[model samples]
Target: MVGRPLPLRDLGFRSTMELVAEMPKVVRVCPNGKGSVVLKGEA
Candidate 1:
C-alpha cells in the first residue's frame, strides 16, 4: 500500500465524466487544470 486508499464515496462514483465534473472547484484550479482518468471497479 502507498497513499491512503481513495474514500468509499469515490469508489461508488458512476462515471469518469461525472467524477471529473464533480471535482471540487479548488482542485480544478490547478495550474494544469482539469484532468480525467478511468475508474475500474472490483469484480
Candidate 2:
C-alpha cells in the first residue's frame, strides 16, 4: 500500500508464483485456498 496500485493488466502473462515472489512482505497469497483471491481497492 505504500506505492502505486498494480494494475491487473500488468499481471497479464505472469504466473501466480511470479507475482507471489514479487509481492511485498506484508502481502500474503494462499495458493491452496478454496476460492479465488480478491484484491479490494481502486487501481
Candidate 3:
C-alpha cells in the first residue's frame, strides 16, 4: 500500500480485505509495537 501494487498482485489478491483476512494467521492480536490498543481485543 505504501510502495507498490505489484506485491499484492504477486500474493494473488485484489483487495485489502482479502489481505487482512489472512493477517491473523501470521500476526498476533497483542504485541502492539507502540504498546496501545487502537481496537479492543479479547483476553
Candidate 4:
C-alpha cells in the first residue's frame, strides 16, 4: 500500500498482514518505493 513504515504504523496497523486483513482490496504493497511488490493480497 504505502512505502514507509511510519505511515503504516500511524494508521494503527501493527503489521502488513494486519493491514491486509482489514483491507481486502489491497492487491499488493510497495514498501521499498522502488515499484516492488512486498506483499500480495489474499482476497
Question: Using TM-score as the measure, which candidate wins?
Answer: 4
- Please estimate how well model 2 matches the true structure, expressed as its whole-model Cα lDDT: 0.55
lDDT of 3 by residue, 7-26 (tens): 76778888755665567655
Candidate 3, run of 10 with poorest lDDT: 34-43
RMSD of 2: 7.7
Task: Count clashing pairs, candidate 2.
Answer: 0
How many clashing residue pairs appear in each of the predictions shown?
Answer: 0, 0, 0, 1
Please give the ranking of all candidate structures by lDDT, highest first, separated by commas: 4, 3, 2, 1
Model 1 CA lDDT for position 13: 69
Every candidate's lDDT: 0.49, 0.55, 0.57, 0.67
lDDT of 1 by residue, 1-43 (tens): 3687545466676654456556655234233344644433323
Candidate 1 root-mean-square deviation in Å: 10.4
**Which residue pairs in model 2 clash with each other?**
none
Model 3 misplacement above 4 A = 25-43
Over 4 Å off in model 4, which ranges? 1-3, 28-43
In model 1, what are the clashing residue pairs, if there are any? none
Local accuracy of candidate 2 as per-residue lDDT tens digits, 2-38:
6976454576735655665566564565545766764
Ranking by TM-score: 4, 3, 2, 1
Top candidate when judged by lDDT against the true structure: 4
> Over 4 Å off in model 2, which ranges?
1-9, 27-43
